[model samples]
Target: MAQDSARQAPAAPAAPARALLASFLPALAVGIGSSVLYLLMSGLAERLQEVLWGPLPDALGIGPYSAVWILVMLTATGVLVGLVVWKAPGHAGPDPATLGLTAVPLPVGTLPGLAIAAMLMLAGGPSLGPENPIIGVNVALAFWLGHRLAPRAPGPLWPLLAEAGTIGALFGTPVAAALVVSEALAGRPMRGALWDNLFAPLTAGAAGAMTTSLIAHPTFDLGLPPLGHPGWADLLAAVVIACAGALLGLTAVYAFPHVHRAFSRLGHPMLALPLGGLVLGGLGVLGGHLTLFKGLSEVKELAHDPGGWTAGQFAGMAVVKLAALLVAASCGFRGGRIFPSVFIGAALGLAAHALVPGVPETLGIAAGVLGMLLAITRQGWVSLFTAAVLVASPTIIALLCVASLPAWLLVTGRPQMQLKEDGTAIR
Candidate 1:
């Protein structure tokens, strides 16, 4: 009887594996759920955009791409979002400028208003991505569902899983999630092996990436020249361009609080949002379509034919996009700043290439993106990954890594782009 019991008992070492396998199913479900939610939210916004910019304008007899229509649509979008924030449940959660990528799960009741506001921002040409708000919604939904469906699951694990899943879906790759989460979790002491904690999140990220891929493929490729063998000249140019981009990003960082304070002084969403919309509209008028939206497509457009634009034009686009980003963020638009910063960096890099003539287009762009992202995100690994991913050139990776050293130094002790609860800089 004793021998039989011993044979039946599970080995202690197998516990980790068993736990990981057990967590996998819930993680996968959460990932898929997050992706589904993302798709639904994005789809709704896309349809609304079509209506606002396409059929509605045509029906009203306004030219589809008219600046007047753009102005009207953006201003109206701000008003609608403001109304939701003012009257909707939970006041749309919290000010996005005060939040980061991760936060405590919000109440399920707040999701509706948050979703509405985010959708409006997306469709309205805000210079922000859907990452921040969508991640909050996903985390809340995942936690709520987990409690009902899997009572035994750890409470803390749900947020991590949800964040990983949403990040994977956002970038359409698990690698980005891994890098970001790893960077966030680095230096924090934990009980288990790092990989052990990472297993569930990675599983979730993979599921999310696969699910998002079924609906649409995410591509950052700009079709730039392949970064070939790097010479001494290329390295020198990379550092110079990277520093330049970092300086520009720092300028925005310094101006962010002032701009945010200016908008907040209105003391009412109704007053603040419309005024912000007006400023953004004016910026759009100055910068044209290339400076609109979250900037993914616009970055690609700018890179497609770098020679088509003058140095002055590229500089103008960068400045205008940075301004749009600041205004959209401060005015209660719920979105992420990464995409807009990436766009600004790309434009700055193109301008550098135009002026220097010595820097390769791909190298200059990678360096510029690295520097700006470093300043904006304050994450070296994520910044490096973002810059290298744009060109997908192995030759540029070494150059980017080296250039990031100086860029990091410049931004290390500087004020971050985020704001505190009291609307002060988070320095």
Candidate 2:
């Protein structure tokens, strides 16, 4: 009788356990693939420097390769962009503004564009970062896997969840990446089962963490200052710093798209990239060696050892980096703004610190990263997470909440690009 009643009643069937696994499987593949890709790309970027620039140490009577890296990177990037523009289906490639850390199912074809572009840009010395490529490659791989394993995923937006999870896992911060995914999906009403949502993030995050560990043992040290008890002054300063970051971000948002558009409109991809290379070369000549490539060394030096550079040098490098970022991104170079922006912010913050002695280095660095992220991607959670993680200190945790205020305020509006349910873009 109980069985008959249970059968008769209109009960919702329990979801298949396999469905959950299938939904998250692509993310696992992407996480694994991306970890390998990151390792290779990181090595390639480093080796390209050692091989190409290594000889210059003795011949030039100077330190390292000097500013020639920009030329090298620009030429490589030009070739890569030319190939992508001519051969690739999506001429433009992965759009970070549209995807965030969320897994949006993109064609496998887009992956090559993103991968090559990132590698070249990094190798070529563009003021860009690897995170975007990491995201792009993984997201594409996941989508491809999803299509093969569970054909229904693209339709259900599982790709986006997987991406968020993978990113969270990659960064060793599931909650933070989840927050970014949620921010991207902010306006949308929840459609899937609660379990599906929960499991997807968990799997993706776990895969990312495992993959990262497998590739590169995680040993993150930011040389953070002790998080002292915050007095009213510190709180007040945080507010001021956050607001300053907002201003800086606003400037970047307004400038970046216009730069990209202007460069895209210039002649053929081949010619444009080379010309862009020339422009980058000229800028490098003017900006000093530190401004040539991705701002990693500069960021490391500035953050940990301020005395390594003079105030004039810091100010000059900041301008050069900012300009290099704009030019490289605008001129059809492939890479993400996240790293360059963070480095720029760090430099800017350090410069500010020199002027104002009271501001802690960690706090200033955090504020700069958040500010730049807000300006470039309009990703609130990303901006907040990046800033907090840069310090990697528990005391800075409270300030993360505080610093997020400006970013939250700035990025509160509806996204400029929206997508339809069928994976067709909606403006």
Candidate 3:
């Protein structure tokens, strides 16, 4: 989904040589610093999850992930997160409903509480992801410390580097970071050649990516049976499933504001978040544990045992997870929609295969992820990257490329899953 070279270039002069060179050192520092922060935040969440789901439950003599435990932990998490957002400095950095993944950095003092809220949601089984808040924290820290350390560097350089680095760490690759940065740069008047502009950010991204790979060995491969080649039918199925997934995601995109407004009417996170958690508890009971959490592991579980659930069950999980994502985002949770959207796509793809054994599983999955991501994020390259990465089959790329066109057509110009300052959903 890289734009053609002609389109990427802008009719503008190159950046001043001195400023560009000054940016590199700080860019490298920002990249590494941001990724380390990402790891610390995510690691803390994982450890907390272990304690919450492991020894505490074992000590209490309750079955792990029992219905009661799910409800209790999630409700407690909501109450705790509510207290932070209610009373903490800067109210945990604004309602997530009003921001996209790319947002102005929060103040430095606000980041600690925001990180805590995000960790709670991650460990507490809300259908959300760490991407947004992690990026926000990283951006804030980078901007604050980076400016002081490299005062002569361009002001915009540090946060952009941190954003690229954090995204690279999140996806375990630099290409995602490159694509996202490129997308952001596409319309603005540019300086220098494309690569000149990209050099520092890409360097930071590579560093961040390598750091995560060496430390966590992160990956997206779902271990699905591979498809050797695709046919006309596969192409058609890809288009159909991509569109279907877009529609599925559209349900949430369309519902976001109404839901946000509903919770906003409740007048406080103390009231709204706990009640949202209760509603999410009901969803957990219906969708089971597979529909909970940030959804990376849950999606892997679904992919591993697609045969374990019936088609109806898969469909139900997809719908319920979508609802869970909507609720979590609309009701004061500090998390992102992408991972849960990934889960919904995987579940919908599995449901497609279950309904029609004729369709290739890989095709169903790539198209599903493509459609769902396109609808949710409204970004083409990352959506394509995510879908193709999960299947880990280069042969599926041609089909995904074609499928994304129709899916993109369906999602273009619609209200995004994110809300505007006036609270209407818009991209």
| Whole-structure CA lDDT of model 1 | 0.88
Off by over 4 Å in 1: 1-14
Candidate 3 accuracy as TM-score: 0.95
Candidate 3, run of 10 with poorest lDDT: 11-20
lDDT string for model 2 (1-427, tens) is 9999999997664665776766565655555555566667767877766654566444656545455554554566677766776577776464333343444556776766666666666766667666666666666665666677678655445456456645654465566556665665566676565545556655566666676676666533467686587666666666666666566655555565566556657767787677777777777778766676777666776777865666566666666777777776666666667667777777766766666768777777777777666766667677777777778767776776876776567645623222233323223
**Model 1 Cα shift for residue 164 (angstroms):** 0.6
Instruction: Report the CA-based lDDT of candidate 3 relative to the real structure.
Output: 0.88
Over all chains combined, what TM-score does candidate 2 have? 0.82
Better of 2 and 3 by TM-score: 3
Two-way TM-score contest, 1 vs 2, winner: 1
Task: Give the Cα error of residue 218 in candidate 3, in Å.
Answer: 0.6
TM-scores for every predicted model? 0.94, 0.82, 0.95
lDDT to native, each model: 0.88, 0.64, 0.88
lDDT of candidate 1 over 148-247, digit per residue (tens): 8888888988999999999889888888878877876786776577888789889889889889998877777888989889899998888988988898
Cα RMSD, each candidate: 4.2, 4.7, 4.8
Best by lDDT: 3
Q: State in Å the error of residue 20, model 1.
A: 1.6
Worst window of 10 by summed lDDT in candidate 2: 414-423
